[model samples]
Target chain A: MELLGIMLAVLGAALAAGFAGSGSAIGVGIAGEAGAGVMTEDPGKFGLVLLLQALPGTQGIYGLLTAFFAILKVGIIGGEPVSVNVWQGLGVMFACLPIAIAGYYSGIAQGKTSAACIQLISKRPEETGKAVILPAMVETYAVLALLMSIILLNSISF
Target chain B: MTLETGYGYAVSRLRAMELRILGKSLFQRLLESDDFKDAIKTLGETHYAKWLSDDKGTQNFEYAISMELQEAYDEVDRFTPDKELSQLCRLPYDIHNVKVLIKGQILKQKGSKKRTDLLTKLGNVPIDDLILAVESEDYRLLPFGLHRVVPESLMLWEQTHDILSVETLLDSHLFLTMRQLVQKVGYKGVEAWVHAKIDSENVRNILRLRRTGMDAGRAIEFLHDGGWISKEKVLSLLSEPVEGWNRILGFADVSRVFEGVPETGNVDDLVSDIEKALDNYITDVLRPYRYSTFAPENILTYLWSKEIESKNVRIILVGIANGVDKESLRRLLRNVQ
Candidate 1:
């Protein structure tokens, strides 16, 4: 029963990495499908389309960073686990929720935007700058959530 | 809600293909061409060169443009995962073939030579297969319930031999299937377009009945099943004069289509103008969907654009061949945009 706190923390970390990574996978996949279609017609746009397809992949990185921080706080990476109280453990778990939830949803939203941008480039390759900017707009919320999770994780004391 | 944004790959591919569709400038160039051969030469420079490069000569421009339209249909069918949307677009061609085949068989039986050249190859069903099915009177191999429509259409034509009746039945079958597919697709844009189309057909029917001195009962009885304006509303418009139709229909913006309609303008020349106007109205109904990201309606819009492009090219080529004036030819082009 005393190990429940760490268990919850681990579950929180898993959720942060798992759902966010899943979101990125879906987002990147959608963008890739669109990219392939564009490239099928004009293979010259491969470099630009590849960049658009990579836009949705950032959420997975943010989620992994958040998970790594949580693991570091628990000292799990050092093979010496911290003696965290139930409250601190709950605090850590809750802190991870921001990135977990935000990354999961924002990543998919960014992917749709990226796909739209890919289509834009297909039509007007000169507008690649605008295409990149549109999907980047969806990244702001994910960055905020990552920052929030980090600040909250720092405040929790063992 | 999930169905709203699923067509990412198909829509993107279609956007790329749309770049190949002849735009306004190319249409202008074709119009400026000195003659039919010059128009064909100009087309040879575009992606349409695939067929023209073979040196089929200028006389086969109809065959070349028709092939382009067929490619658009086949490509949409191949790219889209949504079978119903593709079927909705392809069904008209199938029904057209069925109508021709049924009439051909009937005419051949009565010692008249059937015009095989009129059979369209753009339908989902192969022309030969559809021909065999219709000739044998066994439709088990047909799709989209064409089996039912085939025998029924043939029976109507055989009993009455009224070409109009056979064609109307085939069209109703086409529109009714379109209505059902629209419901199944559950996309609001498609529903809006189909309703507008049905409404336009209904409005034209009642107006034509009143114009041709035919009984209003025929239109009311044969009115299409699905439309935004009610059948009762269309019935009410039957008694109203041509000028009052715009107000009674509740869509005042469409008053322009009826502008030149005289109280008794029954000439076939003017009929095409009103038909073009109403068709433009329907195309305008779907114009908003062109901006959609991943909806199937976007692909449908591209298909319409392609069809319009093909029609305009055909108009220009045929007009140039016959020495028609530019302004007069321009009047015949569909204002789909």
Candidate 2:
């Protein structure tokens, strides 16, 4: 039963990292395609397009951080194994749910936003700052999810 | 093939290219220029500058324009993964070249001067292949249904000895092909535009037949199928008197075109006026796509707009060279702005 509790906790960490990472990969790939297209026509706007392309990558980092924290608290990395009850293990997995769901969706949404911004900047290079702000706004929800997961993980008695 | 999300990059690239398209003001500048040379000089200052050099005269401007159009089509072809989607735009040119080649071959048999110079090099089928197909009478090299249509058109011509019949046959085939392409693309806006275009062409054919004192029954034979309006409806509409046409087709802008024509009006003038009205109507139909962002409609609309721009430029250049009046040229040009 204690082994089951540790396995569930590990599963929670895996879901948080796996879901968010895949979402970021898809988002960044979409943005990169748009960036490459823009660069083909106007090579001078590379810096601005690159900035937009990198916007969706934040969710992956947030997801990884959450997974790292969960693994550390569960003592899967470096520390001695902590015996956890089934309910406590389930609690840790539940804590990751916010970031796992939010990060996955937000990453994809931010990618579409970034792609649109890249298109805008291609037409009007002077508006790069304004374009950056639009996609960055989508990142707020992702950050909030990360914050919620971190607070939940921290508050839980291991 | 399903249109994938891969269009993101191509659509963005098209959006950027849209900015470089010549506006009404630029065309106005070309029209207002004092003479042919002045107009040429003005055009040289535009995006057309690369194609124009000091030695290239107004006589070669048509060739230059054709080359530019071919380049634009090639660029669009390179951008899209679906070759058939891009080929849809070039189908008309292919049909046109085939018509010219076949006609030229027939004319050559009579020992006339071959007018191959008039054939455009802007189609999907190479000029050499078109020539070979026409000369050999085996059209396996031609794409779409033209391989069958070419020989069948020739055989029909031999029986009827009517060039107009042959022309009508080829036109119907062309529109049929276009309709199939639009259906395949599945873009509602483009499909609608193509349907409207076919209906307009039918209207024009009917009106032309009426002008020439041809019967409604004979006019129906020339009408192309696959338009928004049914053949039965077209036949019923054609049976009405000329003045009554306005009442039947009043919803279309084309109805207004037939309103003011005098009984003794010149055929050439009437045809030109009708052509202008149809051109303007088609342009209006496609105008909504100007705001469309990522769909195939944007690409289709851009290509249409570019073709119209090319036509307007040609009209201005040719009008200037021939000393055509500014007001008349303006009346003839389609508004792309």
Candidate 3:
């Protein structure tokens, strides 16, 4: 039963990395397509396009950090496994949910915004200052999710 | 991608290209230029400068303008996948080329000089392929909408012994193909455009028939089917005079177009006004999609605006060259701004 708990906790870590990383990939791909199109017309706008393209990628890093924290708290690395029972392992798994689900959806939504910003800067490069802010609005949710996941994972006593 | 196609890449590229489009001020500048040479001089400073290399004063300005339009079509084709709305818009150009090729061949057989200069490479079908297809009497070599049209127009000319018959066949076929394409794109704006355009053309044809004293029964032969107005509804207008057209068509709110039709001596001028009203209606229908992301409507509207821009430039340059007053020329311009 205890082994099952440990496995479930690790499964939560896997979901955090897998689902959010996949969402980031899709978002980045969408932005990249729009970026390549802009660069085709004005190659000088590459810096602006690249910056927008990278905005969706941060969610993947956030997901990876959540996974790392979960495994570390359970002592899946560096030391012997913590003596977490079935309920403690279950609690740890639920703690990872904030980033796991939010990062996935937010990543995709930010990508679409970033692609639109890339288009915005392509037409009027002078507006890059504001264009950067449009996609960053979507990042607010992702930042909140990361913060919540980290706190929950650390606070849950085993 | 067929139904939910994303034009993100194409729209981004198009937005940059839109920045280069000549604005109304530039058109007005060309309109007020002192002479043909002066207008050409002002045009030389714009994005059209590359196309102006062959500018032998005013002689080849038309060629430069046509080439610029052709390049716009080429860019849209390159950026969008599938046989998109850009290619559909070129259907008229392709039909125009076919009409010339077939007519040129027939005239050549009759001992007339072959006028190759009349042909434009602005259509989807390659000029060389069109020429080879017409010369070999093989319709299969042409594209979907055009393949069957080549031989059908020839047979039409042979049967009626009237070049008008061939023209009518080609025009109706062009609309038919355009309808098919607009349906395939499954866009509401384009569908509205095709309906309004065909209905507008039908209205014009009915007016011309009434003027010519042609029988009303024969007018049906010239009308196309994809319009929003049913054939019976449009045909019902023949019994009523021109002034009564608004009363009959008012049910569909189509009377709005006919409201501008002058009652007196300039029916021809009123025809242009009706067309202008319909164009404005279409422009309004498409304007909302202008800033939409990843939509084919965005591309379609952009292409239409580019076509409108080219038309205005042509009218201004031609008017300046012909010494028409600026006010009269301004009246002729289609309002999309």
Candidate 4:
């Protein structure tokens, strides 16, 4: 039973890193395709397009941070393993759900937003600052999800 | 949502390409060019520079523009996710090739080369394949939906032996085919654009038939379907005088074109003016898509704008070669920018 508790906590960390990283990969890929297309016509706009293509990557970093905090709370990295009750283990897993689900979806949404912004910049190069701001707006949800997961993980008395 | 993403890359590239298109200021410069050589020099600075340099003289200007148009079509075809959607823009060119080939065949037996050089090399259908299909009467070589029109047009020609009848049959088929393609693509904007084009063509046909003294019943035969204007409206307009056109069209720009012109003046010039007015109206209708980001309408608008630019260039160069005054040539050009 105690083994099951430790396994569940590890699973929570894995889900956070795995799901969010996958989402970022997809989001970055979508934006990269659009950026490459624009670059094909005018290579001079590379700096602007590259910046737009990187906007969806923040979610992955947030997810990784959450996973690291969860692993550290459980003492799974280097210290002696902390024996957690099933309730505490389940609590940690539940805490990860916010970032896992939100990061996965928001990454895709931000990717689509960034791709559109790249298209806008392609047409009006002078509007690159405005284009960057549009996709960054989608980052707000991912940040909120990260905050929820961090607060929940810290409050749990594992 | 998934479908819009499918076109993301293509639309992005098109947005970049749109920047290179000639603008109003460029047209102004071209209009003010001193003479034929000066006009060619003006074109030399635009995207036409490479094509113009290769030709050396303005004699091959039409051929160069045609090549550029083909390249543009090819670029769109290469990028679009749906091949049929891209082919939608090429339908007019395919229909045009069909007309030329059929006419050439009919005129061949009479030993005339009237339309030999009129065939454009810029369609989804290859010129050689279209020629062969016309010769063999096997339309499988043509695009998917266009096969039946060729045989039916030939049959209509056989029955009436009237060139105008054959042309009317082919034109009606072309518009119907365009409507079907737009429906298949499922874009409301493109459908509206197609309907507007049909309405404009219908109005022009009505005016031409009325001016030529053709009976209203006969004029109805050439009227195309799928326009916003009903056939009944066109039928009523056919019986009315040319001065009443402005009242029926209801578009201020179009009405303004017909307001001051005398009814008894030169019919050719009047007809040309009306055609220019319709072209300007269509250009105005397409202008909104200039800012469109992801819709296929942007691609359609760009293609139409490129064709208008090509036509305007041809008009200026041909006018200069013929020593037609700039003011008279300016009257015929559409406000593309």
DockQ of 2: 0.47
Report, for every candidate in turn, its global Cα lDDT versus the true structure.
Answer: 0.81, 0.80, 0.80, 0.80
- In model 2, the Cα lDDT at residue B298 comes to 64
TM-score of chain A of each: 0.96, 0.97, 0.96, 0.97
Candidate 1 is graded, for docking, as medium
Tens digits of per-residue lDDT for model 2 on B1-337? 1223576787778767766678988999999999988988888887677777745534578766776677778888888755666677788888888778767867887888788887777778888888888888778877878898999888887788788888888988888988888877777877877877788888788777766778777888888888777766666666687567778777655566566554435667667777777766777676776554356666777677778888999999999899999987987787664
DockQ of 4: 0.53
Off by over 4 Å in 2: A78-81, B1-4, B54-58, B235-274, B280-293
Model 4 misplaced stretches (Cα beyond 4 Å)? A1-11, B1-3, B136-140, B240-274, B280-292, B323-332, B335-337
TM-score of candidate 1 relative to the true fold: 0.92
lDDT of 4 by residue, A59-120 (tens): 89988999998888888897777888888888888898899988988888888889889888
Per-candidate TM vs. native?
Answer: 0.92, 0.89, 0.91, 0.88
Q: Itemize residue pairs with steric clashes in candidate 4.
A: none
lDDT of 1 by residue, B16-108 (tens): 888998877888888899988888889988878887866563458777887888888887887787777767777778888887887788889
1 or 4, greater by lDDT: 1
Candidate 1 chain B has its poorest 10 consecutive residues by lDDT at: B260-269
lDDT of 3 by residue, B12-117 (tens): 7877788878887888888789988899989988878888866452478877788778788888888786455887778788888988987897898799987778
Candidate 1 residue pairs in backbone clash: none
Candidates in descending DockQ order: 3, 1, 4, 2
For this target, which candidate reaches the highest TM-score against the unseen true structure? Answer: 1
Model 3 residue pairs with clashes: none
